[model samples]
Target chain A: MKSNKTNMKYDIIFFAVALIILVFLFLAYFFMTRSNGYICEIKKDNKIYGEYKMDKDHEIDIKENGKLVNAVVIKDHEVYMKEADCPDKLCEKMGKISRVGETIVCLPNKIVITIKGDKGSDSLDSMTK
Target chain B: MGVKSTKNIGITSLFLALALVLSYIETLLPVFIPIPGLKIGLPNLAIIIVLYLYDFKTASLINVMRIFIAGFMFGSAFSIVYSLSGAFLSMIIMTIMKKTKKFSIVTVSSAGGIFHNLGQIIMAAIVMENYYIFTYFPVLFVGGIITGIVIGIIARELLPRLRKIIGFEIKGSE
Candidate 1:
């Protein structure tokens, strides 16, 4: 009978609390880690493959387990997946990224390329408060 | 199995087919987020419906089957792994929430959505062997809330009408 009860008020209060908690968590994490210097961090097979300044354009070929899995290109303060051996090529299709939190992920190749800014905030950085 | 059980299977299959179509439609829509593993989760509607109608077991079956069928149809071999992890985790969380009877459909769905993303991120971390994947968590948490609310609202509106059409006794718990 309790399970069959449809108390609309209870639902509203419960979700409102849940939402507040999520928003709180998001804000806490966002403010704690916010940056905008454009640091490109690359990881392969769970290891730090390399870290490059976005301002310095270059290409990286990552080989894991004795196989060339992904090729990445960083140019013009932007990073993108240039080539991948995976079937979906979703990583390549992810397009160029310049923002602080954008990432290019190649699942099959076990590659994750993320853009993180250095220790300075841009004037337009909204999350900083 | 008896005739009644067979009938349940037949109806469940129909739900599976509908879930497959919804997932295919989702793939066709151009994803706004360039990030991989973010989806509007339209197929969640079917799972929610099955959950409210029958029980967790039926919902779980439909959830796993839909991932397999829809993955092959609209995604790659790799996507199948991601979705299976996501859908299974979402179903378990949602079922637990629903049984508690403390949360509304929307809240349950929102939680389900968030856990769905959590499941995928966990899988990605394992498959990619990278813990840095947690950095994407904040954005995905917000996305899950938004999409979960939408799916929950849709399921709430559809469930009553669907029950009438099927003419099944509204029994709570298995």
Candidate 2:
């Protein structure tokens, strides 16, 4: 019983320290990864489907064999999944992405939307134009 | 000696069966969280129990067999990859904590849970080739802690009762 008490004390200390470190890491990662993104690149089945400018508000319907599978919305310089036929609908609930390195993935549909800062002067000009 | 080995094998297989059933039950439950790979990790109960009752090698054998069997039964090839990574990582953390003997079973299990989620997240990042998937880390970390504590409590309660019935000494139980 005495040994158990000492074990409990150490366990609490260990848990508290681990909790603090993990919380710190979480906050640090969250803040460090936030940045302004310029383009939203959508990939289907690991292939680049299209890249859209974040400045424009538009809806993109991804189709497969004449059936709509997913609907992506870019509005107010942020992108989100508006609708999806996937079973889990996790992508739709993933909220918005407006920063570089942000991504929304639908594994069932094999669709990935990633936010990129800039490709290059030439590609950026062509995309904007 | 032969009889003892046979008894050990019997006990290990029983725990493996229990773990497999728990895995199947998990698949039947509806997705409560929107996170892709998040689960309550019910099968960890059997693995933890086996670890305390036997040794790390025995626990690892059961865990690997459970993941492969459960993965084939209810999941895809991709899921097998995720489970193997998560389970292996969690087991290693739990083993190290258990060896230290400074922490209780619940604390060890909680650590296992946190690392398990981390391992799966790492695998997700690799497969998707995007580091952004890690943004889900905070949520998974919290979830793992909660579920780990729950499973740990259950295992702690079950351990003493199991030892009484089986009439065997546990490795690291106080």
Each candidate's DockQ: 0.34, 0.36
CA lDDT for candidate 1 = 0.79
User: Model 2 residue B98 lDDT?
Assistant: 96
* Model 1 steric clash pairs: A37-A117, A37-A118, A38-A117, A46-B129
**Chain A vs native chain A, TM-score per candidate:** 0.65, 0.77
Error of 1 at A66 (Å): 13
Lowest lDDT sum, 10 consecutive residues, model 2 chain A, at A120-129
User: Which residue runs does candidate 1 get wrong by more than 4 Å?
Assistant: A1-6, A35-41, A45-55, A61-71, A76-78, A82-102, A115-129, B1-4, B168-174
Highest-scoring model, lDDT: 2
Cα deviation in Å at residue A61, candidate 2? Answer: 4.2
TM-scores for every candidate against the unseen true structure? 0.77, 0.83
- Model 1: lDDT of residue B75: 74
